[model samples]
Target: MAASPTTGRGRPDSLDHMIRLTSLTRRYGRTTAVHDLTLTVRSGHVTGFLGPNGAGKSTTLRMILGLTAPTSGTVTVDGVRFRDRPRGLRHVGALLDAADVQGGRGAEAHLRALARSNGIPRSRVDATLREVGLAGVARRRVGGFSLGMRQRLGIAAALLGDPPVVLFDEPFNGLDPEGVRWVRGLFRELAGQGRTVFVSSHLMSEMEHCVDRLVVIGRGRLLADQSLAEFAATSGGSTVSVRTPQEGALTARLTAEGGVVRAEDDGTVTVTGLSAARVGDLAAAHRIPVHELVTRTPSLEQAFMALTATSVEHRAGEVAR
Candidate 1:
């Protein structure tokens, strides 16, 4: 699927980054999960936090929500330290993992407890459950919920706060294709309403169609911070396909013009590097008959793999240890 425009290059200057990490670091004994990472998640956009397995995405989010203290640096919400603000959580609603929900309580009871703690009306509990398509199952024990249903229930709890910023970590893990589409639409609608929606996932292919801006990390280090279009342009170059009646003549001409040419089993030559117009011009100049010409755009998933290949952490040692 083609990626739709998520940002129009008019990034707001509100310092309004709903979430910011300044030189954030987290260490687990000898291993550093996140290494002096710094990033800003602006409002009115959905920022995709992408990385490979064990890339410290979950750790960074834990620090941001104050679930775990950063060994160095700081994480803040609206310029206030995550741990220092009295109402630190009032500005952010997060779903770090499906299991974050209490297994002992019913889904409705869980949401009600949070609502009461935050001084939100009881009516909001039902509203959020229904909003997440969990109204029918809201009364069921959370321990009985499927992973996808649990993810939706978690999202319901996050929305219960009605906070300006929402953070989701691998929300699509067990969801079917339709559920993934639903979550994508929900994030877009939230961002459209001028809220900050930050999500993290190891699946770069799915995110290519889901997120606006991307903050990609590998080996616990920042790799690329860019919009989808910019990343595609840098790593996803275009490929040109050409066809001519005289395959041999066209192949010779294209090769001489610095174009990479490969003849298919059928009688046609595919050329790359030269545009269709340039190829046509060359063919016209060489008196070669042109039958067909086209260009195929590369997928964002391919671009992501090409860009992050070198930065991936080798986990062979960890498994052996």
Candidate 2:
């Protein structure tokens, strides 16, 4: 599948914000599924929502879509909750569960029924089917469709309204590599159109390319709400690697300059909080033989893992309260 069509003016600002959640929470009896969560899905960008399994990602999305009522906070779309209007769904589009499709109905038939219920024209159904690369399978029974095809159909159904805001929860699951790439391009195209594209995925690598900004949650709290660059900036500096035949001498010199040097088994010393050039100057001043000196920045995944290690550790076996 290729990318979907880009709508340059998809989100009309005068219509109000697409979605807003303030101090939102959901309690399941004694367990709190989502706790004091607050986030904003803005227009003109794709926001990645991430958390480990049982980390309240689903609970928070459900509350935003008005499927599950929040225990204590508010979720408002276009400044109104979905329940407040007879046709509240008109302002937004959503594909919360890929498996929620009607198995008995044909893909086109199901879409037609949904479109009719929402007072959308029948012509829009074909347009949406084509948009999601499901035109060939539109008339087939949904029961026979593979999970990837079903996901495409679900996305098509969400686009039927041509709504300003789109919310997809774990839209990439069960997709092949090609399908994943297709979906990533689709998300980028959608955001390019100025629609508020909010998607939830457990795969951070996928989000790294698909989203313009990230709203990461750990143990049901916002860990970060930043652009990719800002997240990288705050994650910290790079590691300086120095390869020297005189490992002991180089390590001693580095340590003397307040640099923490860890001697690797490969005879290279890894220095922290110091630049490679500075290390080279220090080595030259001390007459240490330097074979190689380089600085390697941490990747986004590495930075995220390091920053959230404590949160992840604390949430282990806790079942997300």
Candidate 3:
């Protein structure tokens, strides 16, 4: 899969693996749901869309699928508007809300209907159900299905078209550990196959494990569109942990070398403003016998909170008691 550059304009040769939004703004009366959002979701990686409550994630996704018309600007899948493309399922597969399915319909029946609507073949229905591990319960009524089961059913429906672009909104909401693991692997697998996999999730931990890129929004505006490593690096780099017998000497040496050293309760010292390799090289240069030398990565949740602190529309701490 090719990694497309984030160019300002023009749809390049990577048409099949790009989802671009340009000056996309959606206003409902006095409320602007999405405002002038512009970014590209490239292929070959799972891109996670993150935002606090009322950040317009769902609205933006709806616009991408042509479910809601933008008040101004444009959104395109494969360099063409979703509205202009008929049989849309053939291009993009999305699981916005798992509970949107008809309660009275059977799992297989529901998928069959979607396939028919998209002019997809009936053969895809069973195959997708099997892929989502719902083939055994294909005849079960959606109303009787558990939340996790319904989620799987919804995933099957999205994949029924075998589309190149896949979008998932809060996919970890109703999944068990096994299901979560499966979905994680599935997203990576899809991206590995050159498909554009975009996911919106509040599970920061899960996002850290699965996605390598991030698109963060707050209050209907694009806050950050960067790779996961780059986004996390905004908070600061990693800290290095060192365990040595010569604590005073090492501390003085590290501080003298411009590394911020902090004494830990675990009888070890943590050094920031420098990497593990630097710390190790410094210790070796000073003849310090280091027992433990490791680097701790930055926390994604902490970084996200810092970036979107003011942009949070619904603040829990400000609620009236």
Candidate 4:
């Protein structure tokens, strides 16, 4: 599917590479996997999909790929349903599961099969392997490849058609540190080329660095969808860490002064609804000698946990070490 400049192959067309989900819902018997989801994933940005377990992420992705039917509502790629489009791979490339590939086939053979089915150029297969750093292992059977190698091969297949829209579920699962950095750069480069890139992963730190936008869901419902910065800013958890020998006294003093204090396992107290300066002042006024006082901005993981805390399907108890 080498896109001709005039026919708009490499870049998006008049619709500008948008995935629109309107009241998109899916149900299994009495259980609803997705509830009235409505959002637009636009081109030129890497959108991260996030949720706790059983948030209907896999079901939603399947519905978008036309592999599963929604109970109600609709999902459209570039203003048209995915199933309605002939040769859909040229419009949307996805990696739902890297392990779904045939293990008996060579890496090149697997990609060739995909290319043939999608009407993608046979020659593009080799080029994609080289692009994904799999050229050296093109003829290697997928069964012999490591998890990291399998991930690269799967990425190569997704880029085989050079589609305008791509979705990846946990693309960094088996990547090394170097591979992780490469994938992050790849997402940015694709977004720079005006493609709609939607990725779903539980790695909050990776998402913080990779995605420009975030779409968070919990309990089959939309929890947050906005720019990464905007979502982080909304966490509303500006906290100060206070470490002192008299932790109990300091915590009591901070709480008495209308501050929320959460004890840490490290013998420190995290003070909220107050500033570092106020925490220091309270410690001094209460005659508590402070060892450390530092303000901390909430990370993406912290923000995600805060939003999905109530929505977790099965909360695990702390394991004693």
Candidate 5:
């Protein structure tokens, strides 16, 4: 594994992986929030933790950070439990909730207090503020700031320790387009520095472009864990679109050869259950002149929907007429 560029002062030298969760499970009363989730978050990449509402994402994160005790199993950071670590913040930096900060204090003051408690220098607070673009309003009270500003302040506080493992939960909640773009770049930079960046979000479009690895869960159970490219490649199969002047003849030949064909709106035939190469060859054998033949791969959102269809916890009911 590559070394993290954002290594803090107290980073352990012997550690390899940033986080390891072994059979981690959590429950509340009669309900299970997380079910035997075993995952390893490696360094030098951005991993996206994805799930629908009530899919145990937040519960797992809380367990990893030692904010909530797991009913069973273990979560370790640098081969040590978070609660057992002498200075937990120095090993992992997390932004679980933007509203967790103290409302009465200014942004700078809040960060300074956290730094002081963690034995970090006060100067680091300002530096972090500037890094997250909150230095201009560092003196403004957090309660008076907008949601986006508060989110930035929370991120600044998380970076005060400059830990190798950084986690963000819905960091793009209130961010405008510019802020969202900045966060995307920031995650890439952090990962380039060889740091472990784990972010959780339901926004598949954003995750499609931002994350390298994906850990998808549904209803407290693991659904799929794979790279973005692998996930898309293994999602059933691709559709082949072919446009020919002899649409009727092509459709009949394609269907006869075990291809599911559907007439598209724009005078093209959409072929599934067959490969593009096979379709092209069949068209050639029948002497059908092909104007256009293209294979369309499933988008990230489409693949995710198909994989998690059975795992969705809540469904919008049909409205009353």
Candidate 6:
């Protein structure tokens, strides 16, 4: 039986290792787009590269692909620099900008040209187009393609070489809900096959569902590098919700026990710094009738906001009057 198109053939040797960045820095005149950033994108996991606008996400990606020169340090994939590799596309496939393609040629023709340049087979062009759901319009001129179609074309180009390491910068920008879900599943499938998938997006909600690891940066500097679960746990612990007829007593007891308690409009109390078991035990001891009790973990959006509060480049109402 043939392997599914979604699942590339067995993991290639070229993707057996990780991508390493050592003291990577890029400066453009007086502005530093990327600071001394040392990080690793491990294989078999989907890593989300997150940062605010002007936070250097694109610059870092460009440097990784060897499209832009770094001012200092180095970025290496599988023990070889991208620019130094004889066939770089075979090792690393990236979708940096959707609009970077030739507008005059058809989608299939454009991808065939790229495949030819990178020593990829001609048949892979149509295969990738089908994989990206662009086979129906493969012969249409790219000049009239919508932003979403262009994005799919870019992703097709990235997969043309069947590279082990894939990088996508804001790939979900112009996609609809179905497209978003498809891309999400595609990333997971790619990573499941022991490939390194690094995606950059400003949508915390999207990354929360798709990414296993996160690499957050601000002002060109690395801020947090951790798994999604670790980030949520360390930034702010879970909050316990409690509802009782004796709100005053529960609040007082929780507050006295060093738990930050806030009463909600619906007569429920939100307590932090205390576990649900502890709250229930306390209520039992104090004879407080509990109607509802639940623990809620902080959402990824909340955690990201808390983590990047200090790293934001633009703040609302900061303009001069």
Best by lDDT: 6
**Candidate 3 on 122-204: residue-level lDDT in tens?**
88887787778887888889999899988888777777788888899989888889889888888887887788999999999
User: Once superposed on the true structure, which residue ranges of model 1 sit more than 4 Å away at CA?
Assistant: 1-17, 264-272, 314-321
Ten residues in sequence with the least summed lDDT for candidate 4: 1-10
Question: What is the per-residue lDDT of model 1 for residues 70-93, given as tens digits with 9 covering 90 to 100?
Answer: 899988887876667554435678
By TM-score, is 1 or 6 better?
Answer: 6
What are the TM-scores, per candidate, against the unseen true structure? 0.85, 0.85, 0.89, 0.83, 0.91, 0.95
Q: Best to worst by lDDT, what's the order?
A: 6, 4, 3, 5, 2, 1
Looking at candidate 6, what is the lDDT of residue 21? Answer: 96
Model 2, poorest ten-residue lDDT window?
7-16
**C-alpha lDDT of residue 49 in model 1:** 90
What is the TM-score of candidate 4?
0.83
Task: Name the weakest run of 10 consecutive residues (lDDT summed) in model 3.
Answer: 1-10
Cα lDDT tens digits, model 6, 204-307, are 88999899999989999998999999988776568999999999988999999999998889878899999999999999999999999999988888887787
Ranking by TM-score: 6, 5, 3, 1, 2, 4
Candidate 2 lDDT, tens digit per residue, 241-316?
Answer: 9898888888888888999999888878889978888999999999998998888777667767766676563444
lDDT of each: 0.79, 0.80, 0.87, 0.87, 0.84, 0.88
Error of 2 at 272 (Å): 1.8
| lDDT digits (tens) for residues 179-213 of candidate 5 | 88888988887787777899998788889889999
lDDT of 4 by residue, 1-321 (tens): 111112113555533789999999999999999999999999999999999989999999999999999999999999889999788878898988888888999999999898888898988887888777787888999999888888888888778888999999999999998889888988998898899999999989999999999999998999999998788768646788888998878878888999999989998888889999988887887789999999887799998998898899977895756
Q: For candidate 6, what's the RMSD?
A: 2.6
Residue 18 miss distance in model 4 (angstroms): 1.0
Worst 10 residues of 6 by lDDT: 1-10
Clashes of each: 0, 0, 0, 0, 0, 0
**Model 3 ranges with Cα > 4 A deviation:** 1-15, 319-321
